[model samples]
Target: MRELTIDWTALHSAFQMNMPEVRCFLSVEDGKVQKLPPGDPNLATVRADPQHFIPIDAIPSRIQYQWLDDFIKALEDSVVRERMEAAINGKGAFRRFKDILLTLPDERRRWFEYRDQKMRERIVEWVREQAIVPLNEAPWSADLPEGSPPYVSAHIDEDSLGNLA
Candidate 1:
């Protein structure tokens, strides 16, 4: 089975929440509240396709309004709370993410951004390094023959030879 792991360092700058913990935000619309999912689009967009980048005007009106309401209300109540709530409502996922990202302590946020950027740079460097290795390199240890210089040195005692025989 493949185990799933998360790089929560990105999340702290992105989510404004404790690392490696599940955080939920409630979405409010027309004064009614509902639970939002952890990976809701309003908060995080892991994979971006052209379709996902649809602007607020391009997105269905109902989704846009509900998201704005939830995000705005949460912002009014508490910045942290607002982020969490916006994350849930499936509205303003990117903008809400950007807003929460802006609310972070300047130094800490800058550090996080730097760290994330560095990680990407390092990953690219690593991939480039790996690409240069020859694919056909021998994968096994040397297999020495009997009486070869290496084999003779490896077995100084007659008993070792007898054992192998």
Candidate 2:
């Protein structure tokens, strides 16, 4: 496996970005993530050198919706869970779900923590898939059991959750 000094934060942001108008890539030479808008002159150069620049795909919306559903399922408060279930039923569900979380400071904090943990697990899986052995220690690796894989063991079923829209 090739070892590189990766900017983990930049990589995490690249994975989280889901905008249609932007594209992200990871520079194997420097292990930094690059975001380029359409028509950028440098994009052509990056695309040309496929060996040095690897395209980063954004996490699908279906997977994110599953995260929201799983979080709602784990909540102990039935009232809050019901509100969240309703909030995610139609258009603008992401915004509505966030709005409800904003009113509850503790739940809001918990949501952020949950989301970050899920994203970190995704990042670890992506890194391993790319055959990268990061030279810098990953912040999330500290909690892993000895000899265990660096990823969390949550299953994200895209088709099982159906459409949240």
Candidate 3:
């Protein structure tokens, strides 16, 4: 089989959004979240005030949990871990692991951040070893011909994740 290229950003986004029903809100001025001030306008007032509104994308979305570490940590039952570890070592889909993390909101966030950092480190190492330009910060031409291709991209799929495991 050919070595699969990874789109790390998309993978991150996929994992970060583990909470199917919850949406985290962040402060507009700072990237991190901020508490609504006391006596602050209510949701209705905020909706009426353009200054209080910001595009949803402007808010930092949740960071994705990493299957390697986050999934293991989020598991409540040891039997599940054993099965998961076995699956990870062998050929299997990651669906079960994600199912285990779905209900543990706090643990999910914690593990996500932890594993995400490690995932990033792994990406950086791969970049250095391969001498490839990073997708996040690549040196691209400011002035380019129309319809030019992007400078760099690294896409990963389920098959790639299985191989990485």
Among these predictions, the greatest TM-score belongs to 2
Candidate 2: what lDDT? 0.79
Report the lDDT of model 3 for residue 83.
60
lDDT of 1 by residue, 1-165 (tens): 111122222312223333333432211111111223456664453223222221111223454445434434423337565555655456456565555666666423443443333333332233233232212211110222454432111212222222221
- Model 3 TM-score? 0.31
Models, CA RMSD each = 24.9, 6.5, 14.2
Q: Clash totals for all models, in order?
A: 3, 0, 10
Mark the 10 consecutive residues where model 1 has the least summed lDDT. 26-35
Put the candidates in lDDT order, highest first: 2, 3, 1
Which scores higher on lDDT, 2 or 3? 2
The whole-model lDDT of each prediction reads: 0.33, 0.79, 0.40
Summarize candidate 2's per-residue lDDT along 1-165 as a digit string, tens digits.
778888888988898887877889999999998999999999999989888998998888898999899989888899999999999998899999999998988778777767776787788788888888888866555544566554332433323222211
Give a tens-digit lDDT track for model 3, residues 1-165.
112233444433433444443322322223222223335555445445433332122112222223464456446668756665564443333555556557656544644554544454444444354343433332221222345434332333322333332
User: Which runs of model 3 end up more than 4 angstroms from their true locations?
Assistant: 1-93, 132-165
Please tell me which predicted candidate would have the highest lDDT against the true structure. 2
Pairing residues by index, what is the TM-score of model 2? Answer: 0.80
Q: Rank the candidates by TM-score, best first.
A: 2, 3, 1
